[model samples]
Target: MGFLQQKNSADDSIVARIATLVLRLILVVAIPLIAFAVLYAGFIFLRDGNAPKWVITAVAIIWGVGGVAALFWIFNWIVELFSDTWRARLQPFVFVGPALAILAWYLAIPVGRTFYISLFDRDGPGTGQFIGLANYATVFTDRLMREAFRNNIFLWIIFAVPLTVGFGLLVAVLADRSRFERTAKALIFLPMAISFVGAGVIWNFIYVVRPPDTEQIGLLNAIIVNLGGTPRFWPAHTAIAPWNNLFLVIIVAWLQSGYAMVLFSAAIKGVPVEILEAARVDGASEIEVFFKIMIPTILGTIITVTTTVVIFTLKIFDVVWVMTGGQFGTGVIATQFYRQSFIARNAGLGAAIAIVLLIAVIPVMIYNLRQFREQEAF
Candidate 1:
């Protein structure tokens, strides 16, 4: 035992020395590289070719270099005070610093701003009067705002849940056995590659409108026109807006189905062959085995996927924004937040809407947590 301990200690000592050398070398290379980038940017400015942009670029590079240098210096100082053993332990942050800085700058700051906006009457331009709890109250009371909230809920339940689950299960099951399974999955999953804005633009043709006298270029309208039906404005019609919203939901489903299928397929493959064979031996139908055995066995996965889709639905914005611009009573919470803050120039109301969205995500998150805990227990 003493011999084994001695060997392990020797290995650890060797590893620690290697780590320290690597970290020190990285700091030496990175500091100079960042300095070179800033110097080159300065040279670009001196040449009078987009100098101001180059100056801004140089400033960013300088900030990055300075930050990296300061961190390395502090790390070395701490190591000297503590010991070289501790310096080796601090090496991982040499690679992780940029990611941490980005997260702090972009994600952390925006979240803080949103929270601050929720508390005040922000409107038009500058910081307006602080109105505590007033924005939250307005969210519940205002009729249009209430409708927008209801629409989001409706989308979450009716669209996000069924589409994410059903499409995932369907595609996964269908692709389980087939000569062209890979090709079919590749085709089905292709939509996932398209951006939200791009998807919205593509679907725009599907819901396009044209006058009866003119040629029908819209896909759906052209089909209707050929069927001897009158030309109709799809989004403009109040009776059709909610259904039109479903078209937008279809885009989200198309994008997310690939994600769900990938997860559920893995879960399905992990099912024990013995259990499946036992069910087959008992003369169980494939359908029965799937629903009664397979679905129940993978219930945890189903719940997780549903909750993830629910979060996405709650935070949906771009497709709706590009499609209807929150008109025809089809405005959801996310788009409404943007519209209120930027378009309507009512930052307080926008902040209120954003707060409402934050509250709305809470229940779904709790449900997700419960699912995770249940899975962990098992």
Candidate 2:
């Protein structure tokens, strides 16, 4: 009787484990399916409903965040239901799966599709000739494209990047020494709060010109008038060609300076105070200490900041679109892409330009990843 009882007990224990395993599997599958159904329904409602804009926005935000959170929770809990050995093997993939899926769907797939479309002629992917490298040849050889590349590389990048980074570094250093560091940083960083289009609009008022003797409504024109100077159309006239481009570059610099300042400030703050004191002890002036000690210490952050800004400058569009509509020699690569793709309806050429831009960004991205990995190691 005792032997039979012990055997039965062992069988019962196995049954319970099997039941638990089945329950865990069921929960994993069922939870996600139900969540997906609900999410689909909500998306449809949001798409079709005549609800108040704010109401739709609020619902979308809540559903988006809550749904993702719940899905992650369900997945993690299911993973945790496994034995220690299984859990360890599965947890990383479970947590990382969603992000991988998103990147594959949103980034990798789109890039591949864009490249595929680039091979076709103006009618785009559905019905266009496979032009081989002809579109790319045109991209390089075209007049407007050539001008766009020149403006992007020289005026937008060469001029704006240094000004933004330099001004940011200067502000970061000065703010660090001041008692009102936070306040000063806040004020300087305010430009970053405004959207690029908004900044363009604000600066437009400053650059807006009037008749030479008329009441100058533009702040810049007013100042010029008061100071016994003249206000020309600031974006259109300086010496005819690329000088107008400089004003557009200035807008980008102004907008991005705050971004650079924030990054530089954090990096500057992270420098070991002892090193600065030691440099001073070694007869290094403030200038020498800044250039030698402080800069070297935060070189990684500097590279990161510069690369980030360079990427942004490469893709600049809204500011130029809003202010000059890519007129008056202000067009860059992005604006040129917009003109080709949407404006001119030259889909093939646009795709080639896009591919070129992507190629340009790829090296910078790889370098940035390397820098990030090195920093992560530390």
The numbered model that scores best in lDDT is 2
lDDT of 2 by residue, 1-378 (tens): 454332323334666657646654555455556677879998998999999999999999999889978888877897788866456545665666566656766798988888888898999877888988889999899888888999999888999999999999999999999999999989989998898889988999898898887899899889888999878878877376887899889988888899999999999889998988998998999999988888899999888899999999999999999988888777888999999899899898898899999999999978878879989964
TM-score for each of the candidates: 0.74, 0.82
Q: How does each model score on lDDT? A: 0.75, 0.85
Clash counts for all predictions = 1, 0
Query: What are the runs in model 1 whose C-alpha is more than 4 Å off?
Result: 1-48, 51-105, 108-113, 123-127, 363-378
Which candidate gets the maximum TM-score versus the true structure?
2
Please give the lDDT score for candidate 2. 0.85
As a TM-score, model 1 comes out at 0.74
lDDT of 1 at 101: 53
Each prediction's Cα RMSD? Answer: 7.4, 7.2
